[model samples]
Each structure stands twice: as structure tokens, then as C-alpha cells.
Target: MSTILFDKIIFGPVHSRRLGVSLGVNLLPTDGKLCSFNCIYCECGLNEERRTRSKLPTRVEVKEALVQKLAYMQSEGIAPDVITFAGNGEPTMHPEFGGIIDDTINTRNQFFPQAKIAVLSNSTMLHKEEVFQALNKIEDNILKLDSVLDSRIRQLNAPNSSSFNFDSLLKQLCRFNGKLIIQTMFLRGEINGEHIDNTSESEIKGWVNALKQIRPKQVMIYTIDRETPVKNLKKVSGEDLEIIAEVARKEGFDVTVSA
Candidate 1:
């Protein structure tokens, strides 16, 4: 039950293996986790294990902290390549998510205009109009679609909503119309005695087909890079990821693989 929580609203100009020089913004409670999907491979650990009594940062607080960090970075001649919304959990869960995005955009424009605004979301909240529109406005709306199969998705993502429909999710994603980036986590192993693997032939076939239909601008495939809540999970190999990337490439989608 290992977990990591961002202690501040704005953290890191840390080099991200996928996003590069990134600045993180955590909209969830700093001391706990709040996410729609209780992903077994989440670096932040199990949602229940990391539960807290803390409140989410206010929109004004987020904007002020971001501005302060950006201003100091400016003085130190350090510019972030991207301002990423990802930390303990689903950032869209915040009550003022849309307002926070608006504030972030204004603040980013004032400091690092060249930097992109990216949100790494689990894609459970796409049904919300405000969340959908806010994601559309960002440079990188990286949404997770671990598998095309409903059964596999349930096992891998463990989405909290009973109303979550795989088919409906695909439709909502299609609305992005190539504006979004689809990010998949590739891993294999057993969880609670059930064997799981998304890198299988059938799994890859179905996933690639879904990608073709959704038609995202880019596809990012990566394996677990940190300590996960589930200890039995295994990281997909670099060679295996390249194989998956080729399948995606044949579909005419730009793919990036992180092993």
C-alpha cells in the first residue's frame, strides 16, 4: 500500500519521462487521493488507502501558487515545457475545475506563454460538459483508455461510477475529433488471483481498432515506471511496447512509447 501525495498545490518542474520538463498542479486534496478510477497501477496508491480529511485547494489558491512558482522560475531563468494538471487524483473532480483552468490559462499566458497546458485525466468525467470543454481548450488532453473491452477496463481501471459505459466513453472521446491524446498504460500480471494483460494479441487488436475510430491526434503507450499499489503487476517490456506502437502506427496515428 505504498502511496505518494503532492504536499502542495503547485509542485515540480520535474522532468517527466513522457511530458518532459513539467510543472504539476494538484487540484485534489494535498493530503489524500480523489479519483474516479481506483487503478491498480496508480503511483499514488489505492484511493481508500490514501483517504484524507483535507479539502481541495481553492481556484484563487491554485492561481496564486502557480503564479508565484512561475514568477520565481522566471527570475531563475527556468521555464517549464508544460504545466501539467496531475497529482493525487482526478483534477476535474474539483468544484471550480473550469474556473481553475481559466485562471491557469491567464496565469500561463502572463509567465510562460510558450508552455503548453496539459491535463492527465482518467477520462471518467468526460460526460460532464464543463470538464469536456475545459479539456478541449488545453494543449494536451491526455485521457486514459486502457482497453476497448468493457471487462478489461473494469478490471484495469476500476472506475467508481456505476453508470460508466465503455461505448458511451468512446463516443465522448470521438467528440474530441483528433484534438486529444490517448494514453494507455501497458502492463501484465494478476490482481486478486485474476490474470490480466493488455499487451495480448486480441487486446492490442481491439485497442488499435478503437484508436482508429476515436482518431486521437497522438497515442502514448507506456508501462509502470514507479511503485504501484498492486505488487503483482509486471511492466511491459520496451520491445513489446515497440511492437504495440507499430500496430498503432499502421493505423496512421503518431505513437510514442515509454518503457
Candidate 2:
């Protein structure tokens, strides 16, 4: 079995195909993960056993650890392209998310003033005032919207409950005023006997409509490149990714493809 890449508060300045060398900060616990969506493609594996009230690292803990690691990296003349809030699970799920963002910004500026702070969020908590505020403060607020169709979204993302609505969620995302970077994962597969494919014409049309309404600054289109928890998942080819990128660009949205 392959070991998990990110299982701690400060894990990497690992080379990312999209974000370049990123120093990761995981707000979720080292032992187990916590997230709103148990995505089939999540590298962290499915949230099988919930530890909802587990002790997440405090803001001070994150700040101190990150500051120490960052200081060491700087002294060694190693600079990361971005300090990312992405690891075992959703960073926004942390109770002190806002404070942690503030602390990261302050500390990172003191060290590598040039590195950007990015957060990879599932967009489920965008309705929360604190989550919205914290996301707005980050340099790269990359949010996920796999598909706009409610049925497909529920099937693909496997969100925690029935209360998750994609339409209303898009409306909330539109309020961001183009400050967000929307990311969509393109994949084709069978999950539990259901044909799980987002590359269909109808599905892409719905996604395009949602992108038009949200008007995000950029759209990062990519497919699975790692071992997914769910078997039988097919990776979208680079050619198909380019085609999707072209479709988004024609709609006047900035698009980047990572196949």
C-alpha cells in the first residue's frame, strides 16, 4: 500500500503540477481525517469512521509549527511557490479557520513574503460567514464544483447529508464576485453499478452554465492522477482536458488544464 502524502500540519514543499512547490498546512488531525464530503477521488480515502469532535490543532499550534518549518526552509534557501491549506481533509472545517489564516498570512509574510497562500476548499462551507471571510482573505481560494446537476454532484462528491444543494450553492459562490478559482475534476467510471461520468455533453453544459453564473477568475481543469479509494475510476486524457479548457475559454473564463 502506498503511504498517504499529507498526514501532518507541515508536510511538503512538494512539487505540485498545478501549484508548484507548496508547503502544506493540515488543520485536520494526524491520526484521522474530517471533512464534509467523502469524495470518491479524495486522496485521503473515504471518511469511513467519523471523529467529528476530535482535537484539531489550535491556531497558535499551526502558526508556531508553520513558522518554524518556514524559517528553516528560508534559512536553507528553499522557497515555496505557495503555502497551501490542503492536507488530510478540508481546512475550513477547522473551528479557528479564520484565525489560522490570519496567523499564516502574518507569519508567511515575515518569512517568504513572495509566496502565495492558497486554500483548496470543497465549497460546502461557503455559506458560513467565517468560512466566506477566511476564503476571501486567501490569495488563491480554489473551490470545487465537480458538476452542477444535483444528482451527479451527490453521486460524485457523496456529501455528508441531503441538505447540500448545488443550485443554492452556486448562487452563494456567485457572491464572491470573481475572486475565486473554480476547479472541476473530469473523470469517467462506474461506482456501485452507477455510470459515474462527468464528460457527457449534458453534464458539461450544466457545468458551463454554473461557471458563467459564478464568473470565477480561473478554472483549473484536471483529472485523477493518483490512486483513488474507489476502484474502476478512469482518468480523463490530456486531449479531453484541453477540449474542456477550450469550452470554458470560449465562455470567457480563464482556464488552466492539468491532465
Candidate 3:
């Protein structure tokens, strides 16, 4: 089992393929996970023991810890590309998510002003006014929309019962008129002996329509690079990812392929 959960405040300046040298801030509990969606490809695995409420670090604790860590890093000549809000579960689910974002921005600026603030959101909380406002403050609001089709989304993401609308979610995403990066995980496999590829004609068409509607600044099409909780899941090849990128490019969207 992976013992990477953070019970405290700060955890790595881990090497990330997309966001290099990121200092992770896991607002979720260190003991277990908390999230709105139980994504099939989530590195944290399914939220088996679901909690009715989110277990997260207090806003003051997070602010103090981050400020201390960042100041130490700066003094030691350590520089991170970004301070990321990512961990065992969804960061936005924390009740003080908006305040935390504000604290991170203020604290990070005092220490590492050059480093950017980024949040890797599952997009489930976009409907919340506070969540939207907090995300808007970040430098790179990287949101996830694995598949636009309801069936494919249900198959791939397995979102909680509360978050079931794929169309409405895309419409809400369009409201973010900032440096938005939409991430799509391309995978091909059989879940319970059923096909789960989102690149099919029908699925891709749904995605394209959503992309046209959202009009994100960039589209990041990438495949699994880490160990997934699901054993039957298959990783899409780099060539296939590039092909998808080509389609998105032709459709007039700035796209990048990272496989």
C-alpha cells in the first residue's frame, strides 16, 4: 500500500510531469481520503469509507505550516515551480477552502513570489459560489472533465450521486475566463468486461461539443503515468494521445499531449 498521505500540512516538492517541483498542500485528512467523486483512475483509489463530512486541516494550521515550509525552502535556496492543492482527496471539499486559497496566495507571495499557485480540482465543486471564487484566485485552475457524455463519465469517473450532470458542469466551466487548463485522462480498457474507452466517435463528439462550449485556454490530453487502483484499467499509448491532441488542435483549441 502507498503510505503517502499527509496528516500534517505540507508534503512534497515532488516532481510533477505537468507542474514541475510542486509543493503539495493536502487539505484532506492524513489518515484517509475524502472526495466528491470516486474516480476509477484516481491514484488515491476509491473512497471506500465515505464520510458524511470532510476531515481537513484547519485554515489557520494550513496557513502557518505553509508559511513556515515556504520560508524555510526559500532560505535554503529551494524553489518550487508551483504550490499545488492536491492530495489524497479533493481539496475544495474542505469547508474553509476559500480561506485556505486566500492564505496560500498571501503566504506564498511573502516568501516565493515567483512561484505560481495551482489547484487540481475534479470540477465537482464548481457549482459552489465560494469554490468558484477561490479557484478563480489561483494562477492555474486546472479542472478535470474526463468525458462529457453522461454514460462515459459515469463509467470513467464514477462520481457521487450528488454530481451527475455532465452538460451543466461544462457550462459552469465556461464561466472561468482565466488561465484554465482542462485535463482529460485518455484510457482504454475493460471494466467488468465492458469497453471503457472515451476516444470512441460518440464519446469524442460529446467532448468536442463541450470543448467548444467551455473554450478553455488549453487542453491537456494525457494518459496514466502512475499506478491506478483499478487493476483492469489499460493505459492509452502516447501515439493515441497525440492523435487526440491533433483532433483538438484542428478544432481550434490549444492542446498539449503528455503521455
Candidate 4:
């Protein structure tokens, strides 16, 4: 029962095998899913099968629908390499999410001032200091650590917070000192019979030792490209994500294998 929902509060410029020509921005409820992580490799599914009576899009309606879709994608010349705060759920759990990321960085500085403003966050709202200063005023603050083991993030990210603390979320991702961007999602699964894998080998050596204490400037591994509300999930290849991205590119970290 997978139900991808992004009924527009400024939707796609699509095409993103890792954020290229993105443009999505649904501050939850174009009708359901308000995530604080219900991720069975979610593509807008799961979270009680998408339920919403709707109401979470007013920061002046996400800066006037992102200034009328960046002024109609700059009059249809359509140039978007990333405006993505992602959709259907968890756009920093919107409560005026830092004034809508300061009106999408002043409407991406009046029409795609060299794009890039991403947010796809699941680092459980970074203990909210205005969502950690609006994800440190974005430019792709990706964030999401699939498993540093809170029992494999409560059986693969089922975190609705029973005080979900992975050492206080790795000290709030080591306070983003390396300017975040560590989005992992490797898979290998099962559900009612318990059997999952975060690309094991001790879950990529404790997620590359918490990315060597959150020194992430980039490290986005991928897997399960859509359609997963929980079936016999298993898609971690592209040469096993470049062998788990060469164990974080041999710890010098700038990994980005997307598969």
C-alpha cells in the first residue's frame, strides 16, 4: 500500500537521482504523512497509510507558493538544480519552520540565485533550536543517519520518539560543525518476521564511526529507490553502494554513491 503524496504546495521540477533539477517543497499535508520518521523506505507511504485532514502550509503559504513557483520557473526556462525541502512529510515538521527557511532564503534570492537550498531532514528536528537554526541556513543540509543502532533505529526508523537518543543524536550531529549532509539509507529487509540490514558489517562499522564524530561535509549513500511501505525490501547494490562508499571513502569522507 504505497501512496506517494505531494499534492503541491509548490511541487517538482522533478528529476533527482540525487538532487539535480529537484524543486519539490511540500510543508506536509497536501493530504497526509507528517513524519518524525516512519521510514520503511518511504516514498510518502507508511505513517498510518497517509492520513491528514490537512493544515500545515501557512508561513504565508510557504512564501506565496515559493513566489509563484519561482515565477513560473523563471518563465518556463525551467532552471532548478535544487529547491527541495521534500514533500508529504517532515519539512522540519513545519510550525513556521524557521519562518519557512526564511521564506526559502528570500525566495532563493529572487529566482534561483544559483539554486541549491535542500533539506530532506529526518534527524528528528535537531532538537529544535528553531530546527537548529533552520538547518544552518541551508544549501543542502541533508541529514539522516539510518542506523547508529537504537536497535537499528527501532527496526529501521520507526522513531516517533520514545526519547530516541543515539547519544543525544550524536550530540545533535556534532552540532553540524562540518556543515552537515550525511544521508544514508542502505537496505535489506523483512517486517513481521524481523530481518533487516543497514548494509551490515556492524552496520558499516557503526556508520563509519558516526562519520568520525559527525565531520560530515558530504556522505550520501542510497538504496531502495521507491515503492516500499514494507514488502520484502532489498536493494543495496550498485556494487553494494560502492562497497559502502569505500568505507566512507577511506575515512577522508566526501562520499556520494547513489543507488
Best by TM-score: 1
Misplaced by over 4 Å in model 3 are 1-4, 49-54
Could you give the candidate ranking by lDDT, starting with the highest?
Answer: 1, 2, 4, 3
Alpha-carbon lDDT, every model: 0.92, 0.88, 0.84, 0.86
Off by over 4 Å in 1: none
- Model 3, 27-94: lDDT tens per residue? 88877788888887777767784332545689998998898899899899999999999987889999
Worst lDDT 10-window in candidate 4: 1-10
- Candidate scoring better on lDDT of 2 and 3: 2
Report the Cα lDDT for candidate 1.
Answer: 0.92
Rank list by TM-score: 1, 2, 3, 4
Worst 10 residues of 3 by lDDT: 1-10
Backbone atom clashes (below 3 Å) for every candidate = 0, 0, 0, 0
Give the distance in Å from residue 71's predicted Cα in candidate 3 to where it truly belongs. 1.0
What's model 2's overall lDDT? 0.88
Backbone clashes (count) for model 3: 0
- Candidate 2 is scored at a TM of 0.96
Candidate 1, residue 116: lDDT: 100
Instruction: For model 3, state the Cα shift of residue 117 in Å.
Output: 0.6
Answer with 1 or 3, whichever has the higher TM-score: 1
Per-residue alpha-carbon lDDT of candidate 4 for residues 1-259, written as tens digits (9 for 90 to 100): 6778888788878899888889888888888888888888798888888878878878998898889888988998999988888788788888888988887898898887898898988888888899899888887899888888898888888899899868899999999898989898889978889899878798799889989999988988898887888899999889989988987898899998888
